[model samples]
Target: MLPHCIGVYACGMGGAGMALATDATKIASNPALGGRLGNELSVSLGWMHPDRTMDAQGPTPPGFPFPFANTASGEQTSQIENYPDGALAFNYRLSPTLAVGAAMVPGGGGETKYAMSRTATGQMGFGNAGAMYDSQVRIRYASLTPTVAWTPSAKASYGASVILGYMDFKSNMAVMNPAFTGLPSSPTLMTSGANELERVYGIGLKVGGVWDLSPQVSVAATASTGTRYQRLDDYRDLFTGPLHLPPNFGVGVTFRASPSTDIVADVQYQMWEAVEAIGGEQPAQGGFGWENQPIFALGVQHRLSDRFAVRAGWNYGPSPIPDDVVFANALFPAVIEHHFTAGATYAISDRWEVSGSAYFAPKVTQTDPGTGDMFSQFGGGTVITMKQYGGQVGLRWKF
Candidate 1:
């Protein structure tokens, strides 16, 4: 699942939120912090819940033999009742500047469902079969990373980390009402599953320096680059075609505004263009390649006292899916252009802390040309629209 692989907190923090990850317990930023372990071991646990809603524009006119044209107004929407996921991580310090760690996190997946009773007329045939259908795609990956950091001097620090992991993908699609009679009782559908437990690896190098411009002020900057994932073939079933994990890089800065507050900002770019659909690779099913997108984030954190703290942040990005490629799968649908989020954290004791956060994505609209603005040729003409929201809570314990 994209949520699991990207880190549950990633939903709200974005790529730049790493500045707040000062300890080994938070998984949002660089894992090298895990190497800062003193003489004790550390562990962290996190959980997330997501809610979503979608509203779509009715299909275009011109009665044709397609799915969209079969309805009074080929438009459909839905609200997901519940969506939940989580993660866990552990780290051990072998020396003052070296640490090893392992973590289990949810990646990302897609889901969409629609139900309606209606009829329409189009060029291909009378539209009534594809009127109702439910489809979904779920993909997930778990990773383990070990890191080493060298704080050779008080002014600068550097490190390297490696990631190894496994991936799984499953897809289910069904056309609730097939047009013809005497056909299979179940809705027309296609399903596929694949599990690839391969040795995937990534290396990251980070360097940062602190300049004490004055006693009460300081400035710092860090930059890193490495492959996030080499190939996504192991989870081919999750996509309409083959895809590859692209390289990523980020640069960020932190400024101390006051004795107990700080502001952080970062801009990261992922070479999403390197990713191509599985179908695109084959000679026949011409691919609808996705374009690269840039993600921007900004956050602020305040220390309330010796053991209490709070933070808030925001992020935005362009949709990864193209408008022309509309796959009616339950796992994912309605990819949009932006996301919004907010969150906070509190310390329960000297050794434990808890945090909570939420995310919201606005609704998006699109039209399928082949389906003729409103219907599915297989069943009834079913029009679809979608949106999403998510929340998370986590616990951190430091030894």
Candidate 2:
């Protein structure tokens, strides 16, 4: 899902903490920025709500073996899903010119549970477009980074982090169609036996920098190298290949608009097209047919008093899943495109603070007319849609 979420500060800013290093999130957003903050630690928990559904193609082969058209109009939803995306970070400044930082947190993930599906299957060679089936996919990724930042001048700084990534992916789908391709010889796709897929540890690196243009303005940039994930041993018959997390780059700027207000803006690019398993043009032959995605975000923070502060932000991006690939990607739909966010921070004391944020993205629906080679044989005119909203709360200690 690449929520692009990390610590509370980053989340409150709509993923715009790279240049505004005010909290512990600096350890994850820009290692170099961390040293500027004294020793600090934070923990956060989050929740998600999604209303999604998938419908069968409008046109199907006459006498299709399944009853997809009949049940395609229903809404399938998971009103709430609570996930743990907590972070703990520490920063140390060895000298006026050198600093170090470290953090552990969730990097990316998504979950989908589809209880509403058109599964009207018949005894045949394979399940028709309309078959009774239940399916779900949940992917989780975590990362630990230790960073070092060097400041050679009062106005410029640079840093790098060693990234250690851990990821787990699971998928389950079953169709009552007697014509299931995995019927007798390869029934693993239909049940729990060999359906689970996992990728243990993947490693990578990140580097970033911030430059002071003036007393109240700064520019920042960060880049991450891609991670090559291990293949799925249990589902070798399904993927037949390996999948990888793509690299990404971002640039941002921050301005101290007033004595109590700061404004931040950012542009980011994810090189998803570099990954073959899911970055191609189609989902068949074990590909997810995904495309590269770009993100734009902005945030404004204002201090009402020494003890109270509030912030709001906007994050936007194109859907990674295209309409042509909506069918196969139904289980992994990360298509929501527009998000509005708001939050506030309360200072419990000089050394303790509480931060919270909330965001909502309107639903995005992709419809595939089904002109590809596979659609003609299987089905056509399918539709997939996803809408999401979430919130988080964090407690921080700064020394």
Candidate 3:
């Protein structure tokens, strides 16, 4: 579900822009549009206010086999005060129908820190999430991309980009002291020294094309190859060899409803089931168990005058994490499914422009069924709720 999460115009369009022709600033969406851009550059800043809450409620089964407390209730929440995802982009035309561009932008990332655990349960069980005491995980990702687009005819254009990606991670989690799990004698049953650090270097690519079917209708598609991140050689104990950014593809259409209004719709699919660190089979034992996700978005733009315009959009996607893996996803919850956005653009002069947007994702909550292996594996019924508020502003110029 992490498909191009930040862009000023795309954010106002519910993140749907595979077919919409935009100015030079909309770098995060379809790169194929570079060929149609004005010879200009822009810088943008975005803010995300994400609120994540985890709650546990359930009963310990009769033969649970642990001498911990009978039943438990716990809650943990996270708010990222300084989570800023920003970008810089420039586009220049080499010929009437050929253009090139470059951008530095946020890839995808998450971070959370908390210190709370159960009294007797320790931290290593499938129930360990209930004991999220002394737990922390962080990811920082960015990409530098150089892109080129070719317009063969006035109605068709093709584009591609080279993605230079970088990511770093650090994690510290608590686990049940091996001694408490029938290994040997120890005074404290909960041990909290499992620390892991890693960084990755990777490269990937994106290719796309737009076809204008008529004077008022157009279609576009984009495909992104997966980026295989190098293993955390320093923390082999925590991760296996390959961690990857799964491949994704998107298609969209733009309809010129009126001389002054436009409509856009797009669909995107993420191959989450293809990644190991993110998607695997045995979450009960240790798989991430994330499912493939498809996202849909629709937007409309209306021009009130020559120098003023407004936009509104809506977006939706299914949850990637099944309740089965809710226990394992406490650190990186990507459960949001709905977004509503609004934006405006103003031209101050023939060459100066300003733009801004706001979006909100209402609370979405998932509760695990505490029965059979689900209950025994999770050991506690886990409920997770996630919500977000975001805003972006930018300045642009024309040559």
Candidate number of the best TM-score: 3
Deviation in Å, model 3, residue 96 alpha carbon: 1.6
- Give the residue spans of candidate 3 off by over 4 A: 1-4, 25-27, 57-73, 79-81, 118-134, 174-197, 371-376
Residue 379 error for model 2, in Å? 4.3
lDDT of 2 at 362: 91
TM-score (all chains, Cα) for each model: 0.67, 0.87, 0.88
RMSD of 3: 3.8
Q: Write the per-residue lDDT of candidate 1 for residues 1-399, one digit (tens) a residue.
A: 134113333434543444444444333245434434443333334443343332222344333233332244334443334555555666666665555565554434444433432222221122224333222334445555455555454444445555454544443332223343522332232322312233333333433333334544444444444325544454343344433344455555667688787666666665655545522221113233345656677766678886666666666666554444343321255255455666566778877767666666666654333332122222222223455566667776777
Per-residue accuracy of model 3 over 1-399 as CA lDDT, tens digit each: 363345677777787777886666454467788877879877778888888876644554344554332224367776453588667888999998889998887777777764443322544333344433334567777888889989889899889888888888776643334344442332132223244556788888888898999999999999988666777665443443455777888899999999999999999888887887677554444346778888899998899999999989999998898876665565677899999999888999988778888899999988756442442254346677888888889877788
For model 1, the run of ten residues with the poorest summed lDDT: 372-381
- Number of residue pairs clashing in candidate 3, backbone atoms closer than 3 angstroms, sequence gap of 3 or more or interchain: 3
Q: Order of candidates by TM-score, top first?
A: 3, 2, 1
In model 1, where do residues sit more than 4 Å from their true spots? Answer: 1-15, 25-28, 35-81, 113-134, 173-243, 278-288, 326-331, 334-338, 366-386
